[model samples]
Each structure stands twice: as structure tokens, then as C-alpha cells.
Target chain A: MRVLGIDPGLTRCGLGVVDGALGRRLSFVTAGAVRTSSDWELSERLLGIERGVQSWLDEYCPDAVAVERVFAQHNVSTVMGTAQASAVAITCAARGGLPVASYTPSEVKAAVTGSGRAEKQQVQAMVARLLALEAAPKPADAADAAALAMCHIWRGGAQDRIARAQQEFHRKAGTARRARGV
Target chain B: MRVLGIDPGLTRCGLGVVDGALGRRLSFVTAGAVRTSSDWELSERLLGIERGVQSWLDEYCPDAVAVERVFAQHNVSTVMGTAQASAVAITCAARGGLPVASYTPSEVKAAVTGSGRAEKQQVQAMVARLLALEAAPKPADAADAAALAMCHIWRGGAQDRIARAQQEFHRKAGTARRARGV
Candidate 1:
């Protein structure tokens, strides 16, 4: 599956697209941040991001979008900004009808580095190793986005299996009930 | 000056823009929400919000953007989402280079109503009366945003005066030092 991972921000949104199947090598399609002009108003900046995301979607045409789950911090002002950034990401994904999955920082780190408590540098190193890139992704946010996509791919297959089993069980139960005509 | 107040959210961002000077009249702006689809990834949703805010900024071009400062909540997930929303607004403001101000919910309510402990409806009513709006702004988020902007205007003006006084004091001290030549 082709996955688009995102690190949401108000001024800059880091995006990484990875394409692969389960237990296979994943390829990076594109990754970068969309930055808004300082002179533009909030609305304009938002629109800039919108257009940027649209272009990315058009280019990648990915099957799913992965985003980092929000994490709370001590700074009130910072928290407010992070919330808005998340809204922007959610709206964009919905508009495209792309299935969106969220990965917590800990989960992403664990998937990439095999440890939830892995430091930033460790996570970056692991991402570099997994992707076999010459160096780690620039701007930690981008690396985090890539890691989220990787985590989703690894865990998504298991989730799909569980969902399928549940569906089959429910279908069989319904069939049994219909047969009894009770 | 025209000031725009923002109540940033993951699903919705309530905005209210008003004339800041003179009688503090309510302008043509009102509160509106931008919603993202649940299916989309969080990153896509955040990018959508960035576009929305950018649109708001471009449309209004408010002299300043005022946002409500949020504290940590009991729910880790909810609080984290709120923080991301806040980040969207702050980053957008910074990108626009507009003076961004923030106020606590209590401060906003106190400014709109006489008491900080006022209920949502109470604060809305006072905001309508204080700004001379024909009716209260629809949705509590909108009212809160307007209240936040109003608080900033009041508080910002006071802060400016205080800053001027401090500058004057410093200037006097410098003059005295030069006269003494010590």
C-alpha cells in the first residue's frame, strides 16, 4: 500500500510518502514541509497549506494517510497551535477520502527503533537504517512522519486480520439465526 | 485596529473579527467552524485546518490574532489534540507576522462579563452587549473567541501603557546618568 505520513504544524507541515507491502521493502516517494509566507494572514496561510496538500495528494495518490497523534505539552500557547495544525491535517485527509491512521510518538518510535522510549537520534538512526538512506531525514518532524507510516504498515496487517475474523464471525452468527427462523 | 479572535479546535476553529477602536463595533465577521472528516489521517486534517486559517487570515487581514490559552486536561488524548490545534493558529500567525496574543478562558470571561466565573451564556450575553452585536454570537466557541479578542484589546492597551511608562522611566534615568557623567 502507498501511505502518506504527515507531521502537522501551523507554519510548516512535514509530509513523507512510503510505498510498500507487508514484510517488503518500502520506498520513499516524497517528503518535505509546506511553509506559508510570513506576510500572509491566517486564512491565506491555511489556504497555502491546503493547496500544497492537494498537490501532494495528486502526485502520490496514496491509499492511506498516516499522521502523528497529538501530544500534550506544558506550554498553553504551544498546545493551542498544535491543535489547529491537527485540524488542518484531518480536514485535508477527509476531503480526499483517504483512510487516515494516527500513530503516537511512542508507537512510531517503537516500530522504527524497537523501543518506545527511544531518543530522537536513535529513532532517526533507525529510520535511516530501515529506509537505507544515506543519512537520517532532515528536520525531526519528517523522520517522525516516516516512522509513523512504517508503524502503520507493520501493525495494520494484524489489525486487518482481526477485523476480518470478527466480520466472518458475525456473518456466520447471522446465518445461523436466519436458518433457525427464530 | 481590527482584531480577529480564534478558538482553535481539531474539528472546528471558531473565529470572530471586530473593529478594535472607537466604540468597539462588531464588524461583518462572525464565528464559523471548519470540520475535517474522520476517515482522513490526522496529518491531512491538520493541513486542511492550515488552509482554513490561511483563508481566514487572507479574508480578514486582522491587525492581530488572539487565541485562547488552554491548560492541561485530564484526558491525555484530548489535551494533546487541543495542543495541536493551538499550534496551527500560532504557526499561522507567526507565518503571517501578525502580532499574536493569547488569553486564558477565565480572563476572557472576566473581560466579557463582570465575573470570571460566569457561565457560557452569561459571557455570550455580555459580549453581545459590550460589542453591540444585534444578537449573541452563535456557538459557545465563537463567543469565547470574541471574548478572547476583546480581552486582548483591553489588556493589550493596558500593557502598552505600562510599557510606555517603563520606557519613560528608563529615559529619565539615562538623562540623569549622562548629566552626572559618572
Candidate 2:
């Protein structure tokens, strides 16, 4: 399945699309960053991000969307802005009626470089090699988006299936216990 | 001028609208909350918020929209979700082509109760008195939203004017410096 990955930020948001599935070779479709001027008002900046993500969704038509999950940071304002941008991405995907998934930073690194603690350069290098690119995508953020897309393609579907299976097993167990009149 | 204030949250988003200008007695137009089910997916919850805020904007056509600025919280996920919700409110205002403002919690309290550290009940009671309401709006969140609206009505215009003046001053100063070749 094709997947679109977004590294959400207020000033610079990265968008990448990859076509692949589990146990299959992945190919890069497109990747780039959407930037907004800091001089603009917060509302305008958010609108710009919304429009950018919507355009990518319309152009790529990926089967699923993956977003970088916001985590706690020392700077409250930065974290807040990232979370806001991430939310816009999620909302846009839902508006398009596409499934959405989120992966943590370490998860993306691990999936791409086989090390959760991998450095940025290592992840970028591996992403380039996996996609057979002439060079790593520029601005690092775009490469990070590529890694996120690959991570989702490699692991997201399997994880969802496992979660669903676990839910089903629990439901059957509960029903069986009810039949025994615990 | 009419002002609409939003208290952004995942489950319970508060909305309040007031009509008046600086130095005029403000009157309550409406106050309520937009709620989303916890059982819903994150995307669905966000879409519900977007639709709810959009409807309010369409109905009220407020001169300005005010959102409660999100702050750091002990719970990372909760704070992230709140920031996301606030972004949706801002995006809606921008989409409607309305100017948007944000007020911190302390600023709202101080504007309503004359104390930055005022208690929730104090702010609520003062909001009721300011707007001549029969009683404080219910769900506390709604009352807080009312306070935010009043705060914007009282302070936002002056702040915008000051910002514009500063910008003009800098522009003139830069031109004079260029003339002086310094």
C-alpha cells in the first residue's frame, strides 16, 4: 500500500510519499517541505499548513497517512506548535477518509537504521540506500519524512492486525466466561 | 465589535460570544460547549471540533475570534491534544477570514477578576457581573470562554494598535538609516 508521511512543524513541515508494503521493496514517489513565514499570524500559519497537507493528499492519494507523534520537549511553545501542526495533518487525512498512523521519533529511526538510538545522519543514509536515491533528501526534515513513511510501510499494518487480533481474543474469552456463568 | 472566545479541549470545547467594543458595556450573545466522545478516534474528535467551531463562526460572524492559549501541563498527551484543538479553532477563524487572538489563562483571569491568580469561581462570578447575565454560564469551561471573549474585547484592540505602531516606527527608522548611509 502507498503511504504518505508527514513531519509536522509550524515553520517547516515535511511531506513524503512511498509505495510499498510489508516484505516488499519500497519506492519513493515524492518528498518535500512546506514552509510558512514566521512573520505571519498564528492562524494564517496554521491555514498554510492545512492547505499544504491537503494538496499533498490530493496529489499523492496515498492509502494511509503517517504522522510524527508529538512528544514532551523542554520548550513548551515549540512542542505546542508541533502538536498543533501534527493535528492539522491528522484532520486532513481524516477529511480525506484515509487511515492515519503515528510513529515516535525513535520508532522511525529503529525501523530505518535498525537502531532506536541511531543518529540523524545514519537514518538519512539508510533511507537513501533503501530508496536507491542519488543522495539524501535535503533539509533533513524531508529525509526524516522518508524514514517515517518507510517505518509505517514496514510495521504499521502488522501492528494493526496484531492489535485487532488481541481485541478479538479478549472478546471471545469474555464471552466464554459469560457462558460458564462465572 | 462582536467577539467569539474558544476554550479548546478534546472532549469539552467551550464557546462564548459577546457583543460590544472597548469602553462599552458588553452583552452576552451566546455561550455553550462542543463535546466529543472519548470513544471516538483522534481524527474524528478533531473533525467534530472543526465542524462545531465552523458552525459557530457561520452563525455569529464575530468581528474577532479569541482562543485560550495552551500551556504546558504535567500530562504530555493531554497538553498535546489541547494544543491540537486550539489550532483547529485558529484555523477555522482564519478560514472564515476573521482576525484571531489568543489570551493566556492568567490574562483572562486578570481581565475579568482583577487578579492574575484569581480562582475559577471568582472569574466566573465576575464574568456574569460584567455581562449582566442571570448567572454564570455552566460547565466552568463556558464561563472561562466568556472571560476570554471579554478579555479580547478589552485588551486585544489596544495590543494590535501598539504592534502596528511599532512596525511603522521600525520601517521609518530603517528608511532614515538608509538615507544617512549608516
Q: TM-score of chain B, per candidate?
A: 0.86, 0.87
Q: Quote each prediction's TM-score.
A: 0.63, 0.87
Tell me the tens digit of each residue's lDDT in model 2 across B130-152.
99987999888888888899999
RMSD to truth, every model: 7.5, 5.1
Give the candidate number with the greatest TM-score. Answer: 2
**Can you tell me which runs of candidate 1 are displaced by over 4 Å?**
A10-12, A35-49, A74-81, A180-182, B1-6, B9-21, B24-125, B131-142, B145-182
- Residue B44's lDDT within candidate 2 is 92
**DockQ of predictions, in order shown:** 0.25, 0.57
lDDT of 2 at B133: 89
- Which residues of candidate 2, in runs, are more than 4 Å off? A74-77, A160-182, B73-77, B159-182
